[model samples]
Target chain A: MMKIVTRNLITYATLLLAYTLLFRFGLSSLLTAEKWIWVKVIAVIYGAMIFVTAWMTGRRDGKENFLFDAGFRWNLTTGIVWGLVSEGWFLLGLHSNYESIRMIHIPLLIWSGFLVLHFSLFLILKRRTIGGVHKTDIFE
Target chain B: MTTNDTFHEDLLGAWEETYKKGQLTLWIFLSLKEGPKYVTQLQESIALFSKGTIRAEEQSLYRTLRKFYHLKMVDFSSGKGHKGPDRKYYHLTPLGQSLLQSFVERNILLFFEEPLKDLLLS
Candidate 1:
């Protein structure tokens, strides 16, 4: 389906861009932003995206967000790896001052935003495994 | 009746039981997907789940998702396309796929009713 293709493209493309930009700059740039205003603004936007994404996801899943079964151990590990990988990529970009690095906040925030969902999902799934589904009645 | 139908009847009965008791939160979950959808979209899509069949607060929907978070059947992540917060979204997990698969492939707790009459009705 077109939607699946598009989703895959967007997901992978964003991932590719995240790494590309990460290679372009260093983590230091995050702390050493040319404009603190954009940095904060982007952070707020990223935080919003995190909240909205989780909220929307919650609505869709009906309070049983199962993907989180993997738990915080995996989520946090992936989050850190994701952040580090992007940071490393951006750090690389910073050295050459690549023109490809536009809207620096977008990709960085995306990386952060994923972390939030990762945590939620981890919690959800882990909980389900522990609690078990509500017992189904045998007769109608 | 054939053995298959006989078995399906039993499964169907179980599905009905859970469905009636409100324990089958799993059904509402299948309606939600990875893409963004309005509340109305879900209300219409699920099987035997007509409009107003299960009225819920927007917040309640999120609350139910708490169990799913536990079940590991579904999850949410950030949307790729927008900056706005109005449109909500969700996606199923590997476990959810397996759960749905068990119903279809194994015919475990399969539901067949008048609306979809040809299915294995109990």
Candidate 2:
């Protein structure tokens, strides 16, 4: 259990690092004085990163490895779904009337929390499914 | 016969048929004693060791392996086959070894001796 949690934490950390680098170096410099074009570029990079990670993580040879827990399709699909939802929510926040700098951070924070929550949930559910079979007392 | 002996007899009677669902686990464990084996190897070994009296269909064998994998009694790892795509190898765990040992010590196969003796004497 500890091993699974640690591995997943590593995956999350890697994801965060990737996004930070994407925005900090790639998006920030490219988007200067032109927000939409840079956002599109960053979106494309993010999409490509999702595809690459999914492919790497889903490799058949890595099935027994620690990193292959939730599987490629699960990770990529959930991420894409959540990303779209977050984008919509961010847009909603922008269009809303009571907008402030403090409120602006809320949607992004919630989206980040959703990522952690989704990853953790997937791990727990998988562990439970595997662990549940041992309850049959086959050893006894 | 004593109650335990009768129960043993009954169990052996049930295990006599090679296609029975119950004996598949024992057969799988017996086949794995040497080391890790691929699915095809396991299938061939079971049939050969049983003198062609026992055989497992590919689907059933795959399902059994999946269950054993979940139960942690076996480890499934990929290995290159001499020909074709990579084959999944099944290795018995220590837990599996001990459990199979317990089954052997039970002398379940002893029930076959009477029939064997009759055949030899005749």
The models' CA-based lDDT, in order, is: 0.49, 0.62
- Model 2 CAPRI quality: incorrect
The sequence of per-residue lDDT tens digits that candidate 1 reaches over residues B54-101 is 444555455555555555766666544355565545567777667666
TM-score of chain A of 2: 0.44
* Candidate 2 error regions (>4 Å): A5-19, A58-62, A66-104, A112-128, A132-140, B1-28, B33-122
Taking the tens digit of each residue's C-alpha lDDT, what string does model 2 give over A16-124? 4556445444543454445667667786877677666646544532332323344533454445554454454446542233224444356556756876777687667
Superposed by TM-score, candidate 1 places the C-alpha of residue A138 at a distance from the truth, in angstroms, of 17
Question: What TM-score is obtained for chain B in each of the predicted models?
Answer: 0.50, 0.71
Q: Give the TM-score of candidate 1.
A: 0.32
Q: DockQ each candidate and list the results.
A: 0.09, 0.09
> What interface RMSD, in Å and to 1 decimal, does model 2 have?
7.6
CA displacement after TM-score superposition, residue B46 of candidate 1 (Å):
4.8
Candidate number achieving the greatest TM-score relative to the actual structure? 2
DockQ of 2: 0.09
* Distance from true location, Cα of B118 in model 2, Å: 20
